[model samples]
Target chain A: MELTRRDALAALAAVGATVGGGVLAGRYDPPRADAASDAGSGSAAEPTLSTDLLDLLDAAAEVVYPSGVDGRRTFVETYVLGRTENQPAYREGLQEAAAQLDAVARDWRGQPYADLDADVRDKLLRDLGVETAEPVADGTITERIRFYVVNDLLFAFYSSPTGGRLVGIENPIGHPGGIESYQRASMSPSSAERSGGTNER
Target chain B: MSADGGSGGSDGGVGDGIDRTPSPSADVCVVGSGPAGALVAHRLADEGANVVVLEAGPRFEFSERTAQQEQHIRPGMEDPWEMGGPRDAYSTEGRHYPLNAARVKGVGGSTLHWQGMVMRLHERDFEMQTRYGVGTDWPIDYDDLRPYYADAERAFGVAGAMDNPYAPPREEPFPLPAFPPSYSDSLFAEACERLEIDMHSVPNARNSEPYDDRAPCLGYGTCKPVCPSGAKYTAESHVAKAEAAGARVIDRVPVQRLEHDDAGETIEAAVYATPDGTEHRQTAGQFVLACGGVENARLLLLSASEQHPDGLANSSGAVGRFFMDHLFAGAGGRLDEPTRQNHVGFNTSETHQFYDDTEPVEGLKLEFLNYAGPSPVIEALGADTWGDELAEQLNESYGTHVAVGGLVEQLPDAENRITLDPDRRDDHGNPVPHVEWSLGERTERAIRRANEIQHAILGELGASIEWTVGPESTGPAYHQMGTTRMGSDPGQSVVDADCRTHDLSNLWVVGSSVFPTGGAMNPTLTIAALSLRTAEALSASLSDP
Candidate 1:
């Protein structure tokens, strides 16, 4: 529904292709369970998250998802770099977006965004209306910068195949199916009142 | 030719035929490995008839790529992103559609992506001319095909709801009980009852339990485009059965034409082309065309010769005429609250209360869309929400989404036909099928009624309108039927009641192509039943004194 990592991974799969009796696709197959579990393991050769722009984005990610900051950063770097692998034009655009994000952070905190205190960082996001959920477009430069960080960067981490596991969807796109069966409580008022995931609306 | 050539232990073929010549002879040769072809082949081979099945596409050896299948063919996604195959290679010479016809080219055929909706056309659907005075009557009635339907259900391992007076009359119960419906199904049933409508479990050719050595549905919720689990029935299961029963199935060999006798009343051999530009002829006592509607008609049209200047089976000029597809339509809207419907075994229930209502030839089944969820909504609307707030919103609204719709029956018109493209060619250098079709006045009228009903049903479920889609964008090409229609008379039909072409005693047409009218039901089950019936007739004819 949210164009999750499954949808992106789906783009790489073709029916005719096979390798050693295994399908050529499955960026998240069961064999890759080890890779997903260790999403934080990065090497020096990975240049995607090396930019200062990514550093600031990673700081924001750290505040939002403090428990798995390294994993989130790794997942984001991998997804972004994977998407921009073929298009130099799009890659450059992302780099430019990072520079713009830095500019916005400088104006807001009187310093580079990543260097701001945690309180200042939180207040800056709240003040810029970055906490809003609906997609915003045709906006101010600051508004666009806020969107890039909160929506693009944060979403890429949580929406990745590993990120889906962080939530509750066990068989997100690219992953092997066969989760143990269990009934989920409905999002009705009675269930919502009894449990927590669903709201009373 | 004897099925075993009288040496019947296990190797069931003419042992020296392969060593002698390239032409292989069989008791029956079938074109198209879809439902009709696979079922007929399986049944005939089991009946001790040597059968050869020629499929025009690859067998899709990559079975484990569920995501690719999900993206390419799952029945109702927002214009499924295809994996690019010959299935989606045909051209439309006539109308505008938001999506191309969801055709699956392989041994399993379109069934590889079907939703497993196994429903029977009502009794009145077979006698539309006598009942509603709208469409041509089927050569045979429901009673004639009823036994075959039951047989097909058992053969296909269908899980169905039985003992309902509302369901089509049957002598026996379902092979397996119905798959449990989702939360939305219950809500929709309540709404339907409140609105004074009857809803029933959709009879589907899917396994609710493990049977036939195949695993039950794992509830992956991808029934269209592809069923990752074997829970849902694809024609490949029958193809495998046919092969196991000694039917020789050759993939990637597109049949070119039928070699007819000088009188043009008997098919002697079927010539086909392999992928490597090699041509071979299979001499058979009988030939069955189960290549779906368009391809069947297209093949017949391609077999034009001096004796039959128009086409091989075009004496009635009906080989490619009367092309029809179920006029598909639906409506979707948001509910007042989350319905807890999305993400459970999707496409679990349907209601046929209004089937055979306005037009005897037409019927409509209402489906409670389990595919409705936040992700589809976001993707459909291109809502680029990415932050934590959006994620929370998605989790909150995951299940509340709802929609309802169904197939509306279409009246057959000769103008809506499949003719060969004069210039365009496929892999074998044969003219590709060119279809000219659109929703007729009757079908559009039916859609309006269906659209209104959907609104009332959703309204009864406390739905508040949020971007509703109606039948305007509905693509009817998904259910290709009625191209090579069967009838009682030779002057007006391509095939007889037994599904044999009137012009050629040994030539037969099966599948939806033989339907005189499409009755707003998914036609795979009916196609299977008819093919089985035809296989029986062919076997009987072959063994005649």
Candidate 2:
């Protein structure tokens, strides 16, 4: 059977999630939550995201991901939930970026960001100039969206095996691949021509 | 002398004379289980001698490497090795030598994070004074180390080819065939051909085809900081073999000081600290100080006594003087097409063509770096756009960059040295090692010359130059050398030709600390060769009487 891009992405994502989750299972110690009231109380409650914020991020991942890739919602959900277990400052930034995204959608589209159409949400992000703005925490809405929203989703996707394979990187950095994959030059146009002509066969 | 004299520690036991200790005794006690100490301990144990190895840090488990590799790749993660704290504290004086960044303290030592590039020093490296009238000549020549170099290659399972025209002479071929030039190296090869520069296979300690019972390279591409596979050679491998051969290797025990006899003629016992802040002494017939270039000198100075007041083995007053380290120079930019960088981690090709050229102030070696570009994840995060625009940006930038780097040799300067810090004290209450380092004028010129050559090659490739490292911006290559230098004279150097301390009879210091002059080549191979020679000497001396 021919392998469609969607099938390949799902298979690669399954392998990636299993490998990443298994390797990081027992040893993955993110920083503890530093709630001021819970500091002396000795609480083990981890920071988490709200349902509405999760919905906004899931919708943002769909607009940010490549058009052909499948399962963006689940991938974004898993990644953003993982972010909640990170440092308190990082988790707060994620929540704040999602809130700002929803606020912008309410002001422009008269609805929440997750309820807008995919094309309208995409245009809304571009109109906010997130594509060209520099990412900065505590900066403008565009900068925050660029940093905590767009870049975070892109990092979640491209760092995974499926997203790497979509861009022709069979094994991204820090991912394991056999020596045979890199023993020869990639079959790019220039390298193919050079190997065919001058370099040792 | 008691263990708490100038040693600066109070909690101690078993510090009587050498004859009284009989319980935890060994034939030899090797400090610092890095390449030098582990090799010496392994060789002695393999030859049926009772040896004990003391390491300052914990043994890193191979099972945790995948997680460690993850920590290394992900941004904003702490150092996976957890190298620095108050225990590993130190200060730099002149040029900001990041000491802990260049070193690790564990079973394998710094080789746990090394790139595994091993090159033998050229003949002129040993005869620097005779050839150029600049630095002092080594007490021993390349011929003395030629056989040991071959032995070291076999011991580390070095994969190489006899292709480096400027490489030092060798009698036997490498143990394994060389890894082929990396795909990105092909791009540099074509440019180097046009510039009339000779590029050849770099000898590496990583396995090419599973030599010495370790797996071959699986291309995990994290060889510098962490190699998930056992392909890359770490001294921990030999440390394990030493254990199997009846050697006792103790980890997380940092040696505070070496206690000597009344005459200061020999090291009687090594006072090391445990986790509970208790100090214990390990006595042996012989002692080898192999705690790398910096710590070896610091330990010697920390062991100062009434007999040798400047320090143990300091009648010459040269224990921590004449410090040296190799610096780096480079130029890199984006190519017109995909160079496929970051696919493989360790470099497979280099050029030693300018190593012996005197016009550029002697030793200079160039490498075609394999992991120069940003990874897919890094590119995706650094992109300014979102959606398909970000996808297009990642495709264009991921593999379009290439770089050329070189190692420039630095001459030994007595002013650039390691001294004991008066203000800061470690967990054991000993003064931390203070490094006063400054790059010399000759080294700056050499770095400039290397950058010129690198620019020529990159220009030939039609690449746009993005960054260049000049003399002011260049940093240490982390190949520490020449702190406790070797010479025949008693008043000039710390160790003799046999790596034996001049002021002490049974105390020997090995590793790059004893080098009179360091060439631009990576120093681990030389450290291994010297360790093998020291091990043989120790074994023979133990056999006597």
Considering only chain B, report the TM-score of each candidate against the true chain B.
Answer: 0.90, 0.95
Model 2 per-residue lDDT tens digits across residues B1-545: 43322242332232422122222768899999999999999999999988988888878898777557755654434687788899999998999999998998998999998889998999999989888988899999999999999999998999999999998889999999999887788888888999999999999999999888799987777888888778999998999989899988877779999999877788899988765566678898899999988999999999998887888888887888888888999999998777777766888889999999989656999998987877877666655566777777777767788899989999888998999999999988999999999988889999999999999999999999999998999999898889889999988999888898888888889999999999899999999998899888888888992
User: Could you say which candidate leads in lDDT?
Assistant: 2
Question: What's candidate 2's DockQ score?
Answer: 0.31
Q: Supply the global lDDT for candidate 2.
A: 0.80
Predicted candidate 1 versus true structure: per-residue lDDT over B1-545, tens digit per residue: 22322342222232323321223558898998998999989988998888898887667653554535433322222334332444334566566522244566678888876777888878988988887788899989999999999999998888877734556788888898887666667778788889997776778788888888777876554566556667778888889999999988877667888888887779887776654455667788889988777778988889999999888788898887888877666777776654554243446677787886764336777777767655422231233333344445555655467888688888889888888888777666678778777767677778778888888988888887564445566666378888889998989998999999888888989989899998888888899899889988988998891
- Candidate 2's chain A scores what TM-score? 0.65
